[model samples]
Target: MLILTCPYCGVDAEETELAPGGEAHLKRFGPGASDEEFRDYLFARENPKGVHFERWRHAHGCGKWFHAARCTMTLEVFGTYPAQTTKPPKAIREAITAKRPGWTWREFE
Candidate 1:
């Protein structure tokens, strides 16, 4: 089972203990953006078979939303971080790099 540690409550929660909240760190296309941009944001998304970033809520615990880096193929968790920022924290990125070399998600280089 996929276990995630809550940054707020310090609870290591299993997959059922949390709620899947879909993709994380999505760039919002608003205001002056073209129609295609908004449509893509609403309809199109990355559904990779490998490394992916996602949002989750500690439903049975602190009830806080957080980001998690997970491997879709192997179900390996890289790490979890706060969801306030636009990308995964530096440490999480480094951890993923150490385990899975040449892995790149969007602009997180």
Candidate 2:
């Protein structure tokens, strides 16, 4: 069972208790943007086979959203952080690096 710690409430909740919000760190396109850009924003997503970042909501807990770094194939969770961060926190990044060296996600390394 996948378990994630809610950064807001500090509760370790199972995946069944949370709602997935999809890939994290997406670049959103708004009004005045080109049609292609907007279209890509709506449909384009990273479905990597290795380490991936995602958004999760503690639906049955704190009801707050957060970001999590985990391996898709192994389901090994590196860590979780608040959703307000623009990128993965230093500790999370380090943890991932320790496990999967040379790993890079989006612009984070």
Candidate 3:
């Protein structure tokens, strides 16, 4: 299994300790964007053969959200960071927190 180093937890964890959160840095459509544009925005993905950005969760440890650059074929973790790296929207934060045990927020400092 790939060893994931938590920037905050200061521990190298097994791949089972994390969860895949899909593509990262997806931008929300502006009011002026067309419906097709919005649909493409929501449905399209890079699926890069080389390096790709993916969201991950510390399922069994600090229980925080984060992103990682992983190789899809090899499942190698390139890096990881706290979910706050992008300062998630309120709704996103709520959704993540809800999935987490106790539904709490852990500030990444």
Candidate 4:
């Protein structure tokens, strides 16, 4: 089991306390965007063997959606930030500082 810190709740929570949402920072289609463009946006995922950015909802905490950089293979959580926060995190930075592949760093940007 992994522990994730809810940026809002400010406490480390079990992975059970959260629900995996989807790819993070998915771009929305603008007016007149083509079907192919929309389809790519909707269905594509990196599914990288290493670190990946994902969305998670604090289902048992603040009920807020947030960003988490996770390792696909190890299910390690690197860091967490509120989705509505002003600044996005530097993905590489979080991944590197994560003590283990499964520990989450709770820091606000």
- Write candidate 4's Cα lDDT for 1-109 as tens digits: 8777888888788889889888776777997999999899888766777666678888988898888776778877767888864445676454555554564333435
Ranking by TM-score: 2, 1, 4, 3
Model 4 accuracy (lDDT, Cα): 0.73
Q: Write the per-residue lDDT of candidate 2 for residues 1-109, one digit (tens) a residue.
A: 8998899999999999999999999988778999999988889999999899999999998899999999999889999999999999989888988988888767754
The candidates, ranked best first by lDDT, are: 2, 1, 4, 3
TM-score of each: 0.90, 0.94, 0.63, 0.75
Q: What is the lDDT of residue 62 in candidate 2?
A: 83
For candidate 1, write residues 1-109 as lDDT tens digits: 8888888888889899999999998888879999999998898888999899999999999888999999999989888888896888899888988998997878864
Clashing pairs in 3: none
Error of 1 at 82 (Å): 0.6
Window of ten residues with lowest summed lDDT in model 3: 100-109
User: Model 3, range 34-105, lDDT digits (tens) per residue?
Assistant: 998899888987777644567777788888777765566776555666666664345444444444445332
- With a 3 Å backbone cut-off (N, CA, C), the pairs that clash in candidate 1 are none
- Residue 6 of model 4: what lDDT? 84
Task: Identify the superior model by TM-score, candidate 2 or candidate 3.
Answer: 2
